[model samples]
Target: MKLLTIENLVRKFSLKVLTGENQLQQTITQSRSHRPGLEFVGHFDFFPTERVQILGRKEITYLHKLSIEERQIRIGNIVKYHPPCFIVTAGQEGLTYLTQYCVEEGIPLLCTNEPQTTSEFITKLDAYMIKTLAPEIAIHGVCVNVYGMGILLRGKSGVGKSETAHTLIGRGHRLVADDIVVLKKLSPRTILGTHDGKTKEFLALRSVGLLNVVRLYGRKAFQDETRIALDIELTKWQKNSLNNELEHEPTFTEYMDVQIPHIEIQLQPGRDVAGLIEAAANNWLLKQQGYSAAEEFMKRLESDSSW
Candidate 1:
């Protein structure tokens, strides 16, 4: 789990501070935001106390309908829950009483200038939180989104991982990460990959020190991140080993607790490694759609006894 703090939200949105400056250090554990409509109506059942409380135009209007004394009591009761923070969107005014209540309870009150409606604010904030708080882990690999499939190139150092990824980019695929790929668990079974912030859009070849992938191949050569769909491991060609034989069942590698389809490629001089990788990606896509050429060939071979 990643750390999401009120301070992070403030910095990302440039929210105006109304009060509770001391509470900026508070953390938000859930990747969801609540609108507090039910809470405002005194319905405390199932209130997401761990999420950021968003007070949008509709909620504020409802508060304005009440007398000052009533509004203060209702808002004060919510503040007592000590939510991670309170975000007032649409830059609405007349929230002084709410601000005072938050200050009294030491709850961070933040306001955004965007003209988004109440529902819009909730949806956007929820999305932002989900992305920022997703579980992440880093690994040594090259990730590329080829034909709408994410292919992760992994192996020992100097095993032509970078060179193969570079070639795939020349074949019109987008490079997601090079050298260091950060994997984020977006859901129970999905993992997203991206380059390290400092090393994005850069690749290292054996002879070449570093090359700007985006600059050399244009902006289309770069992808911020992609859901990892397959893992390809490159290995030095073994003289007599048939490790990549079609008779062998496909294997998988555990990444962030998720099993990714894995393929081992034997590297050798005069071999079209780039083309082979591209074919592997295409074959993975076929398997995803419930088609397997190897299985089909075996079935046909069993059906026909002609030598």
Candidate 2:
């Protein structure tokens, strides 16, 4: 239900407002663009009016070949559809007819530099719109992609979250974010995690200062982004407490209205915390595949006569 407005695009791409300044508040629902060749030819079948109409060299050339009256009638038919906006890529000339019509009809007409080709603009703008429209939130955690699963490790400060993530990266898993993770709700159930520019490929280690994960471990040590599948919280180890019970059931955390599988691990001395995190990730993957060791164990105990 998120909306991307023409004004937002203008600010992001530095677009020139050829016309329809009042219609800058118009919203676009899709991330795709239409060439509008068929619409220009009076063929409205399968026309995507919800997306922006991109006029590149080919479409403008086609219109230039037509008589003024014919071109007006052709382009006029397209204007009747009330598209979100019309973008002229490469700053092509001879768009006065289109621009005037759009201005009079209150349709947004935008122009960009010649170096920005139609395809390049569409691809980049589409991606930007998708990300911009997604619901996002910031989380203090370390996210890593382990065994193709996105694991978000969160805890209080000095809880060994970053150390475990660093260890995981050294073990060949890829780091998605170090301290602050940005989570975008792409769908009702899917959450995508990414980091900001400043701390993307860098991890802050207490003993060694900032470590560039990509440079230290090569490209395989970092992932630009990932879809978060599990959440783990690290806490101090307790002696003979219920929190330390091995028979405790798994937990769930609600994030952006989505229920994520959660785990709580105790931090202690002489413990292989990194390996434990790896095992938790593997167990989460197993549970996703309908394999649960806890449930199997309970079923076996019930079927045994000695139980």
Candidate 3:
């Protein structure tokens, strides 16, 4: 399992480090955030010290109402658990007691760049951590956004997967990634596809060297990420190749255990591979609307038995 370090968190959230600058490299163990409201008043039965501790205006105001000794002692007890870090939300700062205890324990103390409430910041932080820490696997495929559908072009090497995808870009489609696509399983059924940042906006061609996608196609043809909706494989047309057009009942395949609609196209000279992929994306959209072209064709054949 990958962990989110506090240093990256600060950079991501634009957080201002209030204290414990030396412990900025601490890694967050989970996406869950702790308010520690009960722990402030001597209620520490099931305190989750591994989680990121948060303090909002409500908690800060409540602490201010307490006596100096009571506040310092309670904070000391909570800091003894050594949480991954502390986030003071709602723009509240200048906490002498909490800062002292956190610095003594070497816990990174961070504040939001904006004045968002604890609930709001927690919601955003939770989403970020869940996505940033999600397990990912990079597969050898070209990801393209065809007619608003994410289509993964995959097959054996030299099958024109990248070439077909580049042609699709010329057809006004967006390119999510080329050559290598990083797929992160956001959930059991949802997988998002993106490219590695270093090699972004570039494509490799067999005949030509690396082509900058953004330079050739401009920014409209580039996309950072897209939710994968369909997967297509392109294989060289051999003599023993099977015709997939004969029978199609919504084929499917998996990436990182998440299933998506699948199609296999036989690549041959003079074949309109890019157009076929665009059609596949359109067909996938029609399936989402409770319509299947293959099913409709079969119905027509059964009704008009003039064959």
Candidate 4:
């Protein structure tokens, strides 16, 4: 696992570090080799040597109850602790001495403006941390990386996601995974999709059996990892279902507290599903940069008022 530094945290949250600029940056930038000790206190952990330490307003008061020497010792241990960085919730300011110690020792302090209880803050922060720190794995399925966007194909057995992926592959797009895709929630708002290393470069065609796609299609046809930008599901058409009036616009699928753009392409006789999927992918790419063809068409029709 790559330990994230405090400087990166500051950049990520757009926070202003009030003190200990130089030291905090240096301490957080270093790699963490071991896990920190955990001492649970009021929905927060007082880890002696973890890279990240969380401080609440009440926790700071609790620390003040200890002798000056003891407080110094504890703060020193945390400053030198090696998990990655420290996060302060609810914008609670620590004791002046503790803040001074943190500045001198170069320990990064992160503060959030969210006004929630300690437990709720911990739960949400932990979720965000896990997404940021978890490892990514790849699985079997057709993974398409189109113009910097990752589009995953998913559905029941024999749904045309894989076949559509193969078609995209033939059309000069890149593949990230085939069959099983290991998706990791990177943050509350982001999911990182990557190819499982042990099974990367492999795709199982329905009739042709397992094939080494990297070996057959060369390096350009495959990618080691990608951020899951969208999801497309291939489903059988239902006669009673209402078709989406918005063409070439992708929908979003929410999983594990993250929202990923997605689309459902109905499979039916005489429909060129592969071509539609490709067009969908292209249209999705355009939408990411604030262009929506369906919305544009509707705007034109509304403006004309004759159609």
Give per-residue CA lDDT, model 3, range 1-307, as digits (tens). 3668999889988999989888887778776788998898788888888888888999888888889888888788788888999888888856887888878888888888786778888998887887787779988989988888788999998888889888988999988898889998888988889998876998889989898889998998888998999989898887776655745666789877889888888988898989888877887788789987777889999989977
Better of 2 and 3 by TM-score: 3
For residue 167, model 1's alpha carbon misses the true position, in angstroms, by 0.7
Model 1 lDDT per residue over 46-112, tens place? 9889888888778888999999889877887788888888899977888888878887888888999
Tell me model 4's lDDT, rounded to 2 decimals: 0.66
Look at candidate 1 and tell me the lDDT of residue 110: 90
For residues 1-307, what per-residue lDDT tens digits would candidate 2 score against the true structure?
3577999889888899989998899888876677887677677889998988888988988999999899989988989888999888876897889888997789999988648678898888877877767878888989999988898999998898889988898888999998999888777898888897689899998887998998999999999998888898999998865343435576798889977888888888999988988888888788789987878887888899575
In the order shown, the candidates' Cα RMSDs to the true structure are 2.8, 5.6, 3.2, 11.7
Candidate 1 displacement at residue 211 in angstroms: 1.2
Give a tens-digit lDDT track for model 4, residues 177-265: 87777788665777777665666887777888887777888888888778887777888898978555666444578766688887777
Candidate 3 residue spans exceeding 4 A from truth: 1-3, 37-47, 238-247, 294-307
What is the Cα-based TM-score of model 3?
0.86
Q: What is the lDDT of residue 57 in candidate 2?
A: 85
> Of 2 and 4, which scores higher on lDDT?
2
Q: Give the C-alpha miss distance for residue 125 in model 2, angstroms.
A: 6.0
Q: How many clashes in each structure? A: 0, 0, 0, 20
